[model samples]
Target: MTDATANTAPAGAGQGSLLIKDSRTAKRNGAEGRFKMYGLIAVCIGIAMLILLLTSILTSGLSAFWQTTIQIEVTLPEEKLDKSGVRDPEVMAKVTTFGYAPLLRDGLEATIAANGIETELSAKDAAELISDESVAQLRNRVLRNPDLIGQTVSVEVMASGRIDGFYKGRVTYASAERDTNISPAQLQLAEALEDKGLLNTSFNWLFLTAPDASDTRPEAAGLGVAILGSLYMMLIVLVLALPIGVAASVYLEEFAPQNRWTDLVEVNISNLAAVPSIVFGILGLAIFINFAGLPQSAPIVGGLVLTLMTLPTIIIATRAALKSVPPSIRDAALGLGASRMQSVFHHVLPLAMPGILTGTILGLAQALGETAPLLLIGMVAFVREYPEAPWEGGLFDPATALPVQVFNWTQRSDPAFVERASGAIIVLLVFLLLMNLTAIFLRRRFERRW
Candidate 1:
């Protein structure tokens, strides 16, 4: 009767009721809520940073897709361009770009006169607004169509980099006064030209199609060689790494004896995955260039180096993919009178194809952006000429990659090159995004459920 009375007293008499709030529970809930808030804050910070970075890249880089150009009608005197009445190709070639320079200057002066624009700038200064690269363009145009030598044809040419920067808001009149390469009068003349509808910014396809230009001629620089070199290297990587990495993974996972040798190989592959890419560059330099006699700065050498660096990743991803296949699938195939090789190839491989493709593409994308190994192989050299078609053995030719091009441009003293470097970064980022999107699409499209 005494124990029953004690137990039947108010529920909170001896200890706190389980349904009621306790100090420890309240503290624990507060901590959990604080943790959630912290996590939310961290996520927001990361998202904001990403938005800021992308905004910066887009703001600086998008302008590179357009170029400043001036259109003028140049009276190409037959005597100066084509001395021979017959307009012989050899004779036309004898006239240097220097000889064509005065013609362009005269054309500019004539344009100013015709447009009724007033400027106190001298004739030479007026011509200075035109890109020095234009002289070569004019000469090439005449050479291509010798008949146009005698006619007053409308020739459109790039404006000087300074004038271009003016349109892009990179240059100001006050700043031009302090600049040695360009003058206030030149900017005034450029402004006048624009007012007269003779100078304007247009889409710059050459930025993608033309080759790299010299530091002095940043107005004419482009990414043609870098693009081709990168494409070639990626092709090589996809071709070589896919088959070799897959075959090796299959043998290790499905056929090879589970022994020390295989274990050692697996360990080595994992270690290589973590090795610095520059180490592979060093290895490539010694073996490919020094011992194997492959040419320096050749895309072939870069491709081979990238292939080596990419293989370990491909192998690891492929092995994971193979292991993900259900063991029952193998049993089902074996029950249908299939050999070990037949089961893997006909049954397991099909289900794993999506993962294999995703891994291979991601590996290629990584190799595409890698600059260290390519730089070590001498691919950072200035390459002005585009590589030939693949069937012509162009893989062995000297070339630069997109990343190396960005590195090269950033090293220049010109502010224009900095803009170019940013633009190149944008291009590289676009390619990477596309590749990643493709990986995601493939994974979703071909993914199978048990």
Candidate 2:
């Protein structure tokens, strides 16, 4: 009996076998612990990088929201603006921006004199402190209100980009000395105007409302045209891509036969999803513009291109969402004598709505930030006028997109335009974040688990 028990007993099981961990167990535990440590380090590194990116973006771009302006009272002598004294808008409009330029120069000189501020700079040099857009703006204002002729009205004119940059720390006195567009004397005069409360920095509504200015007038440049163009294209994409993509997805996922042709189509759709966005741009340029004779730089053309690019994304996501719906629900609906179509439409689709909407919005967001395709479609053109309303042929009108605007600004020689480019990035980021949040909200509000 003792020998039988000894033979049955395991070797080396007496002292440390049960209480002490084996070498293999300890090695696995050590490996797992190291993996956890590595994952933690990776997460920390990602957070630090994100903080650095946000900090840099906010610091450089926030200043673009504030504009340096010089407020001055100008006496619009009737002889200069409307010699007929008829208060005719047509007659007032006859005086071009060049004709209005002298009045602004005189206005600045008079404001200095009235403020009791003394400066050695000539009247022309002081006028140089104002933006090139000021002349055009004043002209438009006078034309809009012809009665202002022969009356003294207060006008707030934008400071030149150099003068603006000085206050925003983009330019210094030393830098102004080297800049051809500005001088140290001009900056000193700007300082005097500030001391007297004539020059000030305030929220620039124009940055949000006004159109893009020329290379010489960065302070007058705004995101208005770009914003509107993006809105119009988004509307187009949503109107077109959502229905087409979802229908195609439904037909493929629920109704199509599992045949070689369907399999080939499926593979091609996946391939299209992986295709470079610029290829779509080239396709748009060839098909929409070159062959179809559609207007170049039109939002309509851009929307079509983006729609083609976005359809694949929406289709893929919709198919995935549809597949996530449990097969049991469909089986139950069929067991109740419902048609296959009815089962999918009534039971399967409702369950998939949240993901469908999320995918559609995310696809739209991706299309919004797309630059290469838009560039190929000629959306990079400098567009000064707002597109007409949709009913008034607006979508076909020449326009610029936000990403295209950013690209345009970065190509300019002015540092102020660079700042504007950064600001545009911030705006773009906000738009993306809002879109992602909307996706989350819709997912939570409508998503159901079966």
Candidate 3:
């Protein structure tokens, strides 16, 4: 064949090859476009789910922050709260909440009469419209300070949970017919009082500051004690877990010889991360409570349990961070005759601090929302009194953590406790959110590029 003819044949073969390559490229690009679309759809679904969750929580939990209060202008009788007209503790002890109820009823009745809001409700029904704890609250004030016994002071008392619901439009006349704590007539009287401004609904700061009360007094119940308990537990976890976790990571990553033992330990740490949290609860119960003889429901025990649960998480993150550090940096330090500890601590650790902190905070956040381990330690029990002190009560006293408190509230027979439970959840979420945001901030602040 001629040379030109042979060249043309070769060119034709090359053109065929180009066509095949173009077709494959087009098919690959189409597949990539479809994958991108799938990712976008998944992200949209996630955002929609988050929005729904927040809306539901806000709608159900918002009512717990505002409570109906009956403003009573009462003349504190000297004989009731302070019989001796002196600040005597013995005399105050003799008087009970019942003794203070009549005085409160008379004051409320007088206020109603003065307001010209005529109702056929008896004094007992009128007092029932307000909170039963109001009497005890006033009596406690007089017992604390006898100077206020004869003074006419205006006290804003919480209304009964049912009455409060009535004012908030949660309980209607038809619903009152089936309710035992409130009747249709009582709701009607409450509305009348609300109209005259004697009873009104406002934001309740007490819910954030006061301690949890009985189921009958949901309006008075607060998550403050639980919040403090969780704080103490977190403090213990932070102090105990961070150092131990970092130390283990440092030794494993920089100094420890890679042997079968080390490999086994690494595998077990990873496995522990995936273990069921309730299993940790069981372990904590058997080891800490039964064997160690630690106090039941103490924040210290809860902290120790959480520490065990959190250590694996921190260690994994820390090791990953240490691995991310450039070997060149370590070599440079060593070439300058710096000791191994100095090189690791001064250069490597500072670089890895962000990741370590992020991991630690994330683990703590997980511990904060934990309920099962706390339940095993008796943190689910009813605790009315505030803990004495961190050092005094933290190790020995019975305390309820926030998640356990929320769980306890949900199991109550009263509907108001459900609202309180939702409120407690909101508080817990806020705490978790704050911790997560802190982790993000630290990560961004201290992150280094190799």
- C-alpha RMSD values across all candidates: 4.7, 4.2, 4.6
Of the pair 2 and 3, which is ahead by TM-score?
Answer: 2
- Mind giving the per-residue lDDT tens digits that candidate 2 earns over 1-450? 333343455775233444466565567678989999999999999999999999898888889999999999988888888888888887677888888899999999999999998889899988999998988888888888887888889999999999999999998989877888889989899999999998999998888778888998899999999999998999999999999999999999999999999999999999998999999999999999999999999999999999999999999999999999999999999999999899999999889999899999999999999999999999999888999998999999999999999999999998899889889988889999999999999999998766
**Per-prediction TM-score to the true structure, in the order listed:** 0.94, 0.95, 0.94
Estimate the TM-score for candidate 1: 0.94
Q: Positional deviation of 93 in candidate 2, in angstroms? A: 0.7
The Cα RMSD of model 1 versus the native structure comes to 4.7
**Model 1: per-residue Cα lDDT over 1-450, one tens digit each:** 333344466776436555565565567678889999999999999999999999897888788888999999899998887767788888889999999999999999999999998989899988889999999999998888888977898989899989999998898999998998899988988888888899999998888888899999888889999999999999888889999999999999999999999999999999999999999999999999999999999989999999999999999999999999999999999999999999999989989988888888889899999999888999999998888877898999898999999999999987888778888899899999999999999999999898
> CA shift at 16, candidate 3, in angstroms?
7.4
- lDDT winner: 2
Off by over 4 Å in 3: 1-22
| Residue lDDT tens for model 3, 189-306 | 8878778887887898888878889988887898878988898899989999999999999999998898999999999999999998888899989999999999888888999999
User: Which pairs of residues collide in candidate 1?
Assistant: none
**Candidate 2 Cα outliers beyond 4 Å, as residue runs:** 1-18
Clashes of 2: 0
- For all candidates in order, the CA lDDT equals 0.90, 0.91, 0.86
